[model samples]
Target: MDIDGRKLKILEAIIRDYIETGDPVGSRTISKKYDLGVSSATIRNEMADLEELGLIVQPHTSAGRIPSDKGYRLYVDGMMQRTHIEPEIEEIILKMIKDRVNRIDTLVEETAKLIAMLTNCATIASTPSITQVRIKHLQLVPIDEHSVACVIVTDTNSVKNHIIPTPKAIDFNICNALTHILNESIKGSTLSQISLDKIRVSIEEKMKEYGTIAGSVLEAIDKTLHQEDMPDIYIRGANNILDFEEFNNKEKARELFKVLEEKPYLLQVLDHTPPNTITIRIGEENILTPMKDCSVVTTSYSIGEHTIGNIGIIGPTRMDYGQVVSVLEYVSHHITNMLREMNDS
Candidate 1:
């Protein structure tokens, strides 16, 4: 049977009480705390309907009911109100982004710390694939007559340097001219996006006399950008998992800690979380066995339209979805905005 208004109200009450108190919610508690205008017996009957529909469950033989995973999905989709981050908190995040613009790894770490602090849950932040990072700046400096240092900076502010050996002896003046040509051609292109042959053809056409020198530099840039290392993951507040009652058990805690440390599971979760969207994975929905009883809230961070990485919070199934979701949503968005500006500037 379709849930009536009264049943929906009762289900909402149960879920809210369970999340706040981390205890099974009895019908009497709902009748007393919520103005459902229903008596204890009536509330109990409605709760039974919810449980029978697999919306809630009783942990013990005679205890009050708690929302099932299905119940949480329903509430999150239909009942949870959208929320906004505080203006002061937004300001703080902006300052952090500005301070750490040149060091994206440090920024990711700091962001993970702030998220864990706000949500009081374990937080993991990862870096974007280097191959997808557009070149923000590239510089060539003559080390001597035979060698030049090629420094490439990506949109994420990660810097990679390669030493290039010129076919012919090159001086400072020659390096400056080539640097200008290279920068203009590759200002916003990633290493993977750059075609060595195409760049060589274009550069040689410009510096018709320096064909060999252009090839050497182009090859070095291609090699540098082709190395797509796994994303760097920074985890904070992992210990916070123990704070939840269900995860407090030593066996369960150890299992989860192992998963976090190994990170195979977290990466898998990141693969499923689409960019620019917040995903909530509840119990049993989590891919990792250790995370079966946990709920994860995740969102991706992007520069321009390219998603570089993701950040997430891990907690018990009875987590405060609204609280964690609001923080994740705003932080991810602000990070995207700031990084986009950083890339452009």
Candidate 2:
């Protein structure tokens, strides 16, 4: 049967009702609650068509219909609207983000807590991978004629410094000149983009006459970039998953908690989320087997043009889509703005 405007409206009502009550939606309930002028009998016939079309499913012969994954997909794609967040909640998030935005760990922690409080769902946040971050500038401060301090700042505002002994007695003036030349060559390249061979060739070519400090500079850059303050995953409200009836089965709850506890699993989910927009992974759409019964809403937060990391909400598929979407969007935008302000300051 064709899903015309009428059929779409009926499908939408069923999904919305199921989301609100966490119960199967019947034709009588739809007829009573919605403004559809059709009789209950007429609506029941349409629901049958929707089930036949694989948009909804009947859990039992006597039970009403609940939206199938396909039905929820359609509803989310078209019918769902992000509700306006309360002004007070928005203010609370903005103030907190501005206060903690200077420190990444603090920001991630606060962000996870705020989102969990607002949405009442488990939250996960990841810091930017330093290797993936592009360099903004590299400065060298002369400690003496024999050693210099190399400070590299990434576009994400990550700073790393290393002190290295010069191969020769390079003076402060030479250190400044080398710093300028190094910045010109690799200023915008990510640490991963700066290959050892490429740096050796570039530096040697530029400073061939000055007895190149290429090897020492490359060593310092590598050490600074690989100093191994690994990107941390901050999770808040993992127990919130227990609040859903769908996770009432002990084994199911344990499985989800295991997924949450594993660093690799959390990393996979963060890596899969698209940057700069809200991505909703519903039920079977989730890549992890244990998360098949769960839904995840994710979006990336950025300091500027570069995306630093992602934040996600994990809950049962019956979770409130509109509210979660609004909260994530608000938090992501607020964090981005605060980060930019921090950078500017």
Candidate 3:
């Protein structure tokens, strides 16, 4: 249906009012609140036209109008005003980073929680995976005569530890020598390219007498490398979904809460979002069964050239899209910058 400029303005006003007050917006309310320079009757006629175009719907025969899914799509794609982050909010985010500079995981978790708190919505953050990381250092520290601890540090500066059993007790000096050999052989190689054969060859050539120890160390490294196939997802403020009056329906709210608890489902949802782009999924547009009554705004965060994970905020369908989109944009940009800095340092 074709919409003239006047009808579009009426639709915009109605949507804005409904979003702000969570109530049906009448033609008289728009005429009095916004100086459209038009009579109530003219505005009503325009609203009728917009309703006929499926942009707005009347919840009741005598009630005012609410923006439909098509209307929200138009507003988000064309009419919604873009908002800027406040300087004070930026300062708060910077302070959060400076306080947790030494702990990468803590920084990401806290940042996600803080965003959720600030925006009064559920926030989800995907921790960087191990596959995208290059091996920075690997060490095999002897724990006892029968076991050695494998410590793998990635290019992202995250460290993982594993223990491997040895056939016999080895002295500290011998363990140190074995560690040197392992590092020299595997230090510069990607985890995927490192193999047991290369490690066996290195041990046969250098540490022949302690080949058993070398075998155990290689096994531990293989496990650590494979661990990257599964990524971690962190969610905060899931209970906040209950606070919205829109979700007061017990059955619908329960289903949504159940979906949020499923990490794999959340991961799939986050993964579907485009890289470095802010995507907004409105009600009925969400593919997940339980999320039909909600809206999700998400963007992927990157470390250098590699897009690692996504961060998003979710709320009721009547969410403040303008504010939420602005906040999400700022958060995604800062998160990417922070991850890059962490990698560099």
Candidate 4:
């Protein structure tokens, strides 16, 4: 059957009511609460039409109806226009970024926490993939006869340290010279852009005897970047999911908690979402089975062509779709701008 304007309005009303009350909405509730200008009989007929269209469903025990996943998909797609975040919320987020966030890791963590606090939903933010960052400074400090400590600072100001064993008779002063040479060659270049073999050959030509030592230290830097290249994911408000009635079941809640606590699974889930778009996944559409009853709104931020980070919020399928989406869209855009400004500065 074709859905007329009346049926569409009724479907929208059902979705709104269920989102507000978390209960099945009866025709009487719709007739009394919404000024649809239709009588109870007309509203009941239209509701039946909605059920026939699979937009709404009736529980076995209740005469009232609730929105199905398809119903919510429709409501968010068209019925609701994009709404701006409130001024108070925008101000809070802006102030937080201006004052508290400096490093990329700290930015992701703070953003996740703020989202969790503002939306009261479980939130996640991923740090920029290490492969996309450029080396800002590479320092080699002597650590006795056998080892030297290699410190790599990225353009984002993230620091990583590694230790490499060297020849027992190696020149301790070799640290200072190699540090200058490595910086000249690799600084301002991304890890992926660095050619370790070419660098080794080139360094050996410049400082023949200590060339191998430079090569050894260079390998340590490479290993450090590759070993920990995975984006560090920050998650917050995991327990917030428990407050929702949908997660009241012990087994269901436990499964979601496990996914949140496991960084690998969360990383995979967020990584698969397309970048630079606001995506909404509802019910069975979720890749995680434990999330079948929940919905996720996600978006990503980037620096130039490289995607720097991703953020998402997880809540019950009956979430306030308009509000969640507005906050997510605004926050992710703000983060993208902030990162570019930081990178340039």
Specify the highest-lDDT model's number. Answer: 1
The collision pairs in model 2 are none
Cα lDDT of candidate 4 equals 0.84
Clashing pairs in 4: none
What is the Cα-based lDDT of residue 232 in candidate 2?
79
Winner on TM-score (3 vs 4): 4
| Comparing 1 and 3 on TM-score, the stronger one | 3
TM-score of each: 0.88, 0.81, 0.90, 0.94
Q: For model 1, where is the 10-residue window of minimal lDDT?
A: 220-229
Looking at model 2, how many pairs of residues clash?
0
The residue pairs that clash in candidate 1, if any, are 128-308
Candidate 2 on 132-245: residue-level lDDT in tens?
A: 567789998888877888887876566677888877777777778788777877888877777777767766777785536768777867876787446779999999888777
For candidate 4, the 10 contiguous residues with the lowest summed lDDT are 167-176
Candidate No. with top TM-score: 4
Error of 3 at 143 (Å): 1.4
Per-candidate total of colliding backbone pairs: 1, 0, 1, 0
lDDT of 1: 0.85
Minimal lDDT window, size 10, model 3: 99-108
Full-model lDDT for every candidate: 0.85, 0.84, 0.80, 0.84
Q: Lowest-scoring 10 consecutive residues by lDDT in candidate 2?
A: 209-218
lDDT of 3: 0.80
Deviation in Å, model 3, residue 325 alpha carbon = 1.8
